[model samples]
Target: MFSTGSDDVGVRKAFFGSLVFETVEKTNGATSITTGIDNPVPIVILFVVLTIVFTMMQIIYRGLKQRRDELLKMSGS
Candidate 1:
């Protein structure tokens, strides 16, 4: 039988049939696990790529709208 004696510990180790398992628990004033992105470079690159793509799309849309308006004016005149 294994007992930690306290529930506020950070790490607990258990052994079962030649296998050892480590379990981490977060308690008050203890170090917690990081669940966020580890690298920012990839995220920044993706953001820049998406921004450029959206900007190009907007430019193309505006050009098409202008061309359509010119054609309509020519047909009406």
Candidate 2:
């Protein structure tokens, strides 16, 4: 049942099948791990979150500073 024709079709089929499988495999034989943010998503998200937090903090600080200055002026010398 292995012979597909009078010639060596079984050998040809096995060879082509192996080549196709190798090409279709996703891993591609990669076995090593990497560090320090392989993708941009985590770093980008962290930067965005920190930027927003810092901006809000600055806004609150400015507001409080203005209120404190106003109170000092109202108290007079």
Candidate 3:
């Protein structure tokens, strides 16, 4: 196992990299695990995407709650 990036939530998205391994004697005792893409760009992009989604959800919830509370208050009045 190999990792190339910080272990933090903020940057963990960039950790969306790859993993590589070899069976040692598979196709002929040769190399087997060779991959790339271990950066922070993907991680950051994912973080932003999630943040947007959560933010929108929170906004919608807040608006619905506010409307419900207002309706209840009006009915009480």
Identify the candidate with maximal TM-score: 1
List TM-scores for all candidates, in order: 0.57, 0.51, 0.53
TM-score of 1: 0.57
Q: Give Cα-based local distance difference scores for all models.
A: 0.59, 0.52, 0.58
Off by over 4 Å in 1: 1-33
Query: Candidate 2: misplaced stretches above 4 Å?
Result: 1-36
Sort by lDDT, best first: 1, 3, 2
| Total colliding residue pairs, candidate 1 | 0
Worst 10 residues of 3 by lDDT: 5-14
- Tens digit of per-residue lDDT, candidate 1, span 1-77: 23345654333432322222233565665544323334466667778999999999999999999999999999999
Give the alpha carbon lDDT tens digit for every residue of 32-68 in model 3. Answer: 3334455657767888999999999999999999999
Clashes of each: 0, 0, 2
Q: Which candidate is the best by lDDT?
A: 1
Model 2, C-alpha of 20: deviation from truth (Å): 29
Ranking by TM-score: 1, 3, 2
Error of 3 at 66 (Å): 0.4
